[model samples]
Target chain A: MKALNRYARAVAELLVLFALYALGTWLAQALGWPIPGGVVGLALLLLVFALNGLKPAHLQLGAGLLMAEMLLFFIPALMSLLDYGALVRQQGLRILLVIAISTVVVMLVTAFTVDAVFRWRMRRDT
Target chain B: MTLEPMPLAWLGLTLLAYLGSRWLYRRTRIYVLSPLILVPALLLAIAAPLHTRYAEYSADTHWLMAVLGPVTVAFAVPIWQQRALLVRHWAALLLGMLAGSLASMLSSWWLARWLALDPAVALSLVPRSITTPFAMPLARDLGGVPEMTAVFVMFTGVFGAMLGGVLLRWLPLRSPLARGALFGVGAHGAGVSRAQEVGREEGTVAGLVMVLTGLLNLFAAPVLERFF
Candidate 1:
C-alpha cells in the first residue's frame, strides 16, 4: 500500500509539472514572448518555491526519474545528424574536430576559473 | 501527430537500446557504453542500414524531444532547494558562466578559420554550446541555418557530457560548486543530467548554471550579431 501510494504521488507530481509546462507553452505562444515555454514554466515553479508554496520533496520522485533518464530525451536530437548529408560529407570530420577540441578547452577553462574565484573568496573570508 | 506503426517501433527500439546501454555502462563502467554515446551510436548504425530517412525518424519521435521542455522545467525544483548554496557561490558562478560562454563562442570562431569553413557554417558553429532554443535564433540572425545550428548544438552537448566526467578526474575540483559548474558551463542541457549522477548538490548547481548560461548567451547574442 505504501509503495503504491508513493507511486501515485509521483505520478500526481509529474502531472502538475506537465500542466505547468503546457500553461507556459500556451502563455509564450499567446504573449509572443521570446523565451521558450519550458523556461517560462521553470520561472513559475521558481516563484512558487521562492514563496514557500512547495518543497523539493513534493516533486522529488518524479523529477528525479525525469532527470536521471534525461539522456533518453537527447538521443533523438543527436540522431538528427542522419539528415544533414552533404554538409556532413564535406564538413563532418572538421566540425567534429572543432567541437571536440573546443569542448575540452571550455570545460577546463570554466572549471579552473570557478575554482580560482571560489578560493579567492574563501581566502578573503578567512 | 499521432504515433504511427513505424515511429512507434523506432521509439520502442530507442527505449530498449538506452536501457540496455545503461545496464552495460553500470556493469562495465565504460565511458563509451554510457547512453549518451552508446544509444545514439547504436541507433545511428541501425538507422543507416535500414535506410531510414531523417525526416521520418524525426517526425515519428518528435514527442520525445517535446518531453525535453517539461524536463527542463523540472529543473526548477532542485534550483529552488539549492538557493542557499547558490547564493554563497554567486561570484564564482557568475564569473565561470561568463568565461565558459565566451570561451565556447570564441573557440568555435577561432577554430573555424583553421578549418576554412564557409562564413555561414562558421556562424552556426559559434553558438553550438548554447541550447538550441537560444542558439537557433542567434544562428538565424547571424546568417546561418537554424536547423544546422541545432545539429551542431546536439553534437557539442553530447561531447560535452562525455568529457565532463573525464575532465573532472584531471582537475582538483574540491567543491560541488566547482564540479557541477564544470558540466553546466561546458555541456549545458545534457550536462545537467550528467551532474545529477555526481550528487544532488552538483545536480542543483548544474541546473542553475545551465539556465543562467542560456540567459547569458541569449543576452550577449545581440551584441555578438553586430560583430559577426
Candidate 2:
C-alpha cells in the first residue's frame, strides 16, 4: 500500500510536467514560432523555475525518473537501423569514419577555443 | 503456440532490459556496459533472432518515445539549478557556443563534401552535432532527411559519450567548465550525461551549452543551407 501510494504520487508529478510541456507546445503552435514545442516548453520551465514560480523539488522526482530512463526512449530510433540496412551496407565504413573523425575534431576544436578565450580574458584582467 | 506481443509486454520488456543493463553497469562501473549501448544491443539481439519487425516493436513501444518531448522539456530543471553559473558566464558562454556551433556546421559540411556524399545526405549531416529533437527539424528545414539526421546525431552522441573523457585528457582543457561545454556542444545529451557523472558544475554547464547550441542551430540551419 505504501509502495502504491509512492507510485501514484510519481505518476501525478509526471503528469504535471507533461501538462506544462503540452501547454508550451500549444503556445508555440499558436504563435507560429519556428522553435520546437518541446524546446519552447523547456524555455518556459526554465523561466518558471528561475522566477520561483515552481520549486526544484516539485520537478526533482519526476524529471529524475524520466532522465534516468532516457535511453529507453531512443530504442525506437535505434530500431530504425532495420530501415537503413541498405545505406549501412553501401556506405557504412565511410559514414563511420567520417562520424568518428568529425566527433574528435569538433570536441577538440570547441574545447581548445573555449579554453583559449577564457585564459586570454583572465590574463587581460590581471 | 506463439503469443502476440502486447503493448504492455513491449513496455515491460524495455523497462526490464534497461534496468538489467543499468544494474550491470552499476556493478562493474564499465562505460561500455552502459544502458545506452547495452539495452539497444540486447533488444536487437532478441528482435533479430525472433525476426520481429522494427515497425511492430515500435508500434507497441511508441509510448516510451512519446514521453521524450516532455522529458526534454524537464531538462530545464537542471538548467534552472545552475542559474547562478549561467548568469555569471552568459556572455562568454554564448560567444563560445556560437563559435563552436559554426565550427561544427562548417566541419560537417566540408567533411561531407570531401567524401563526395550525396547532396541530401550531406545536408542531413550538417546538423549531426546538435541534439536529436533540434536536429530533426533543422534537417528537414535544410532539405535533409530527418531519419538520417537522427542516425548521425546518435552516432555523434555515442562517440562522445564513450571516448570523450580520453580526448579531454589529451587536450589542453584543464577547466571543468570548458571541458563540460565542449562535451555539451560536441556530444549533446549523451555528453551531458557523461559530464554529469564527472561533477555537478560540469554537468550543469554542459547542459546549458547543449541547450544553447541547439537553439542556435535552430536559427542557423536555414542560413547554413544556402552555403552548403
Candidate 3:
C-alpha cells in the first residue's frame, strides 16, 4: 500500500510536469517567443514552485526518474557523429585541443573571480 | 509522404549500448569508459559497418530527443532545491558566471580561429561550455551544427570536470560557493557530478550554478549569436 501510494503520486507528478512542458512549448510556438518551450516551461514551473503551488517532495520521484535516465535520451545525438565523417577526420584533433585549452581557462578565471568576491564580501561584512 | 518506419531494432541497440556502457563506466570510473563516449563509439562502430547514416538512426530515435525538452524542464527542480544558496550567493554567482561564460566564449573563438576551424565549427564552439540540452539549441541559433555542438559540449564537460578538480587544489576557494561555482561555471552537467563528490553544499551550489548558467545563456543566445 505504501509503495502503491508512492508510485501513484509519482504518476500524478509526472502528469503535471508534462502538462507544463506542453503548455510552454505551445505558448512558445504560438506567441513566437525566442525562448525554447522547455525553457519557458522551466520558468513557469519555477514560478509555480515559488508560489507554493507544489512542493519539491511531490515531484521528487518523477523528476528524479526523468533526470537520472537523461543520458539514455542523449545517446542518439552523440551517435549522430556517424554523419560528420569528413569534418571529424579533418579537424577532430584541433577541435579537441581547443576544447581543452578553453575549458582550463574558464575554470581558472571563474574560480578566482568567485573566490575574490567571496573574500571581499566577508571583509565588508566584518 | 511515407514516414520512415519505426526503428525498433536500432532503438534497442542504442539503449542496450548506452545502459551497458553506463554500467561499465560505473565499474571503471574512467572517463574514457563513460557512457557519453562509450555509447557514441559503440554505435558508430556498428553504424559504420552497416553503413547506417545519421538520418536513418535519428528517424528511429527522435522520440528520445523530443523528451529532451521535458528533461530540460526538470532542471528547475534542482535549481529550486538550492534556492537558499541562490539567494545567498547571487552576487558571486552572477559575477562568476559572467566571467566564466565570457572567458569560455572568447577562448573558444580564439582557439577555433587560431586553429582555422571551419566557420560553422567555430560558432559551435561558442556554446561548448554549457550542457548539451542548452548548447544544442544555442548552436543551431548561431547557424552551427547541433550534433557537433553536442560533442564539443561533451568534451568540454569531461575536460572541465577533470581539470576543475586540479584547479581546486591550487586555488584559494574557501567557501562551497566558490568551489562549486568552479565546476558549475566551468563544466556544467559533468562538473555538477564531480562537485557532488566533493561535498553536499558544493554539489548543491554547483547544480544551481549550472542550471542558472544554462538559463542565462538561453536568454542571451539571441544577442550573442549576432556577435559570433
The model with the greatest DockQ is: 3
User: What ranges in model 2 sit over 4 Å off?
Assistant: A1-6, B1-9, B49-52
Q: Evaluated with lDDT, which candidate comes out highest? A: 3
What are the models' TM-scores? Answer: 0.86, 0.90, 0.95
The sequence of per-residue lDDT tens digits that candidate 2 reaches over residues A1-126 is 999987887898799789887988899899997667778888888788868888988878888888777777766667666566677887777777777878887887778777877787788889
Ranking by lDDT: 3, 1, 2
**DockQ score, prediction 2:** 0.62
Candidate 1 per-residue lDDT, tens place, B136-188, comes to: 65687677877677778877877888889888888898778888888888887
lDDT of 1 by residue, A50-117 (tens): 78898878888888777777778767767767777677899889999999998987888888889899
lDDT of 2 at B95: 73
Candidate 2 clashing pairs, residues 3+ apart or interchain: none
After superposition, the stretches of candidate 3 with alpha carbons farther than 4 Å from their true spots are A1-4, B1-6
lDDT per residue as tens, model 3, B28-129 = 898888877778787787778777788888878889988878878888898888788778878988999999999999999999999999999999899988
True contacts kept of 2: 0.57
Q: TM-score, chain B only, every model?
A: 0.78, 0.85, 0.93
Candidate 3 per-residue lDDT, tens place, A7-109, comes to: 8988887787788889999999999997888898898989999999988777888888888777777777876678788888999999999999998888888
- The DockQ-based CAPRI class assigned to model 2 is medium
lDDT of 2 by residue, B1-228 (tens): 111635456567778988898899989988778887787777777766666766777777777776778877877777787778878767667777887787777778888788877788788888888887788878888899876787788888988887788886677776787889888998998899889887887788888899778878887765776776
Q: What's the lDDT of the predicted structure labeled candidate 2? A: 0.79
Q: Which CAPRI quality tier does the interface of model 3 achieve?
A: medium
Rank by TM-score (best first) = 3, 2, 1
